[model samples]
Target: MADKNTQVQLARQPDGEPKVSDFQVAETDIPAAGPGKFLARNIYLSLDPYMRGAISGRHMGHSRLNQGDLIGGRCVAQVIESKHAEYAEGDYIVIESGWQSYCVSDGAAKDGVRKIDPNAGPLSAALGVLGMPGLTAWAGVEKLADPGLGDTFVVTAAAGPVGGTAGQLAKAKGCRAVGIAGSDEKCRIVVEEYGFDACVNYKNDDWEEALKEACPDGIDVYFDNVGGPILDTITQQLNLYGKIILCGLVSQYNRNDDNDFAGHNMGPFVGKRAQLLGLVVYDYYDQMDEFLRAAVPLVKAGRLNFHEDRADRIEDAPAHFAKLMSGQNVGKAMVTIGPESL
Candidate 1:
């Protein structure tokens, strides 16, 4: 076992988009499992856009971070030492381990620790497709929108886990799945890999027209991830009585001031009779088993797919996160902390 645990810490709060200088790497004694606690070495750390707001206390239910605090995140880990009854040595689990090599937890529900099923899929996938992002997609598609066969389902951030997965799920339900993405590469990945009907590159000046061409039947369901003027633009194309699942706001996550957020006009929504359902993944934690039961088989069959953009080590987390916030990462962004197995 290593003598020290290497961790990424907050050096300073970011002004707008985060920079590598906002983080510092440090070494500390590897934590020991105390009474009713377990110690696990992290193997994969998930980097998400939400952490940008989380560290700054801009995200819901998150406190502002202080200097020297471990950067908060989720990780796939292996339990090496345990005094807890529910977890034992060699158990593969996902937990709120933050951006570090090792973590100690009391097997608490509040910690969001979940044992892994090696048979389900890749361990790293527990942090991506078959994990929280996938669950969020499932909830939005299955629970809220519930688009009918041949209904038009359009999603933004189409190459991301939530967007890609939502599009695929809607496609499987026989809905025409159209994706709107930032780049042509992302559009290709969403259309070719995730099997969306068509993908529109939002960066193109003619993209909204392209979206209109793709969804000639009219958009019945809109799975929104990036909220901005784009949301308003898309709403103009939504069919009467359409549904909108408000999943994420990546566009506003890096804003240094709240006033920078653009306000939406409700007049259009009132005219369209659109049903806006806000999504918060925390509300669906209990339905994880139900999600995995449906997702695992599709994942194994290659029907549901995912891509990853990863860094070699924990020290790269800040850079990777910066890339994600800048809308540069092509897929799910993560860091490898340790080998999957010892």
Candidate 2:
């Protein structure tokens, strides 16, 4: 066993898009499992846009993190030592292990520890496709929006884990899945890799026109990720009685204050009679088995696809996260902390 644990900690709160200087790396004594807790070695750390708001205390359920505090994140881990009855040594699981190489947890609900299905495509996938991002997509597609055959589904940030997974799920249900992404490369990945029918590069001068061309009948379902003018613009083209899943606000995650978030124009929504649904992934944790049950087979059959961009060390997480926030990462952003197995 290593004598020290490496961690990425907050050095300061970022004003807008994060900078690598905002974070500091440190080494500490590796912690041990207590009577009711288990010690796990983190293998992969999931980097997400929400962490921008989370560290700044702008995101709900998370308080402001102070300097020297470890940045919080989800991780795929292998239990190396255990005193907890439910978790045994050598178990592969996903947990809220933060951005550290090791963590000790009580296997509590708040810790978000979940055993990995060996049949799941890959260990890193537990942090992406078969994990929280996937669950978020599943809940929105299956539980809320529920678009079916002949429905036109449009998603923003389409190259990402949530957007890509949601599009794939909608496609499986026979919906015409179209994606709107930042770059042509991202659009290519969305269409060719994730199997979306078409993708609009929002960076283009005529993306709105492209989106219109893609959804000639008007959009029946809009799985929104980047909210702001794009949301209002998409609402303009929405069909009457359409369903809109307001899944993320990545464009505004770097705002200095809650009041700074872009306000939406309700007039378009009213004209379209849009059924807007807010999605918070935490509410759907219990449905993991249901999601994996459906997702695992699709993965096995090569029907559902996922993409990842990874950093080899925890020290690089801040830079990777900055890239993710700036809309540069091609897929799910991750940092590898240790080997998947001991």
Candidate 3:
């Protein structure tokens, strides 16, 4: 077995989007677990847009990062050693293992760390389709937006993990799902792979007019993942009592120094009388079982589809993360820390 002390640390505060220089790889002596403690080795590190907020110390509820601190996020790992009764050696688990190769946890008592089924498709799926991103799409569309059959539903960042999943779920619910993405290729994938009724490329010159044309009946439900011009455009076409689920704001994540949305066009919000809501997937953890029960079958039966954009090594995390923030990645972006086999 490899030595357990190796780890990575946050090197500095990111100015705009994060760069490789902001991270520092380190090696330390692994500590033995005391009673009720366990040791885990990270296998897959999830690359998410929210991590961009965490890196900048701009998060609303939690305290921001201090310089040179360990940068942390969700990861799938295997327990290599265990002093805790609930966990055993060789158990595959999900935990807040950070960007490091190994982690120490106080078993199930810790905020993170749950045993995952190794038989489940790919281990990385725990961070993508079967994990937080998937749950976000399911819950946001089914419970929050409550899109009905034949309703015109719009989703921004449409080719991304959350947006793609949301579009599929909306279609499964019998709605006319419209996807808005940055590139023409992504727009095509959203329509062809995810079954979106229509896709609009936000990078196009007549994108706004195209969006208006696509949703002639007005948008009954809007899933806002990129909240700059896309949100502005969608709001303009919202129908009465339209539901808007706010998932993320990737359009502004790269602008860490700014505190203003002065450039946003907010004229549509006033006119539409739409309902806009911010969603954090963790708040609905209690519904995870319900989500899994519903989603697993669909995924197993091929009724639900998910895609992944992956970088090969842990060292590539910062770069891959930047791509996600820049809207350059389609579907869920992930970093492989060690060997590919789970």
Candidate 4:
């Protein structure tokens, strides 16, 4: 067994996009499992766009992750040792161990740790379609948006894990699912593989018009992932009493001022009486298993499709993170650290 652990920490706050120098990898003695606790080795670390908010020091989340802080994130880990009754040695679980080789936990909090069934699809899926992103999509599309049969459901960032999962859920519920993505390739995959009724490439010159044609009856349920001009375009076509699931604002996450958050006519919202609901995935963590129960089968049965852009080592997290923020990755971004236990 290794006596020392390697960890990645935030070296500096990013000005715009994060660079490798913004992080530092350090070595320290691995923590011993305390009473009611266990030591787990991290296998996979999830690199998400939301982490940008943390790295840039601009988020309102529970933790503010500053310089020299151990960068926190969700991971798939295997229990190496345990002093806790609930967990045994070699137990594969999902945990918030951040960018470290190992973590010690007692499984006390809702977001801290939870055991996962190896049979529940691929182990990496725990950090992607069957994990936080999955739960976020479920809470946004099912619990909040509630799209019904024949409803027009549109999602921005449609090729991403959250948006893709939500679009598929909308389709499963008998809605006409439409997606808006950055590139034509992403849009193609969203429509052809994810079963979205249509997908519009926002990078195209006539994207706004294309979106208008895609949602002929107007958007009944809009899952807003990127809050920018695209949101303004979608808002213009919102049906009466249209539901808006405000899941994320990726487009404006890097901005440093109040001006970036402004603009977009609100007249449509007033005339249509759209319901806008902001989402924080942690609020629905308790119901994650409910999401897993629904998504795992779809994934296993090949009804739902997911994508991943992976790095082979932990040292590659920052670069891949930059790729994710710049919209270079095609799907869920992740890093494989330790070998995945079967």
The candidate 3 region of ten consecutive residues with least summed lDDT is 258-267
List CA RMSD, all candidates. 0.8, 0.9, 1.9, 1.7
Report the lDDT tens digits of candidate 3 across residue range 1-342. 566455556788777767778777777777677888888778888988877777766766545676667777789888878998889988988898787777888965344777788776578888887888888998899879888889998998888778888988899999999999889989888998888989999888999899988888989999998887677777877998788898988778878675755476556776777888889887877887788788778778777777889887776777887787777887789887776444
TM-score of each prediction: 0.99, 0.98, 0.94, 0.95
lDDT at position 164, candidate 3: 89
lDDT over C-alpha atoms for residue 206 of model 3: 94
User: Between candidates 1 and 3, which one is better according to TM-score?
Assistant: 1
Candidate 2 backbone collisions, by pair = none
> After TM-score superposition, what is the CA distance of residue 162 in candidate 1 from its true location, in Å?
0.5
Ranking, TM-score, top scorer first:
1, 2, 4, 3
| Sort by lDDT, top down from the best | 1, 2, 4, 3
RMSD of 1: 0.8
- Model 1 misses residue 190 by how many Å? 0.7
* Model 2 segments more than 4 A misplaced: none
Q: Which ten residues in a row have the lowest lDDT in candidate 1?
A: 107-116
Clashing residue pairs, backbone N/CA/C < 3 A, model 4: none
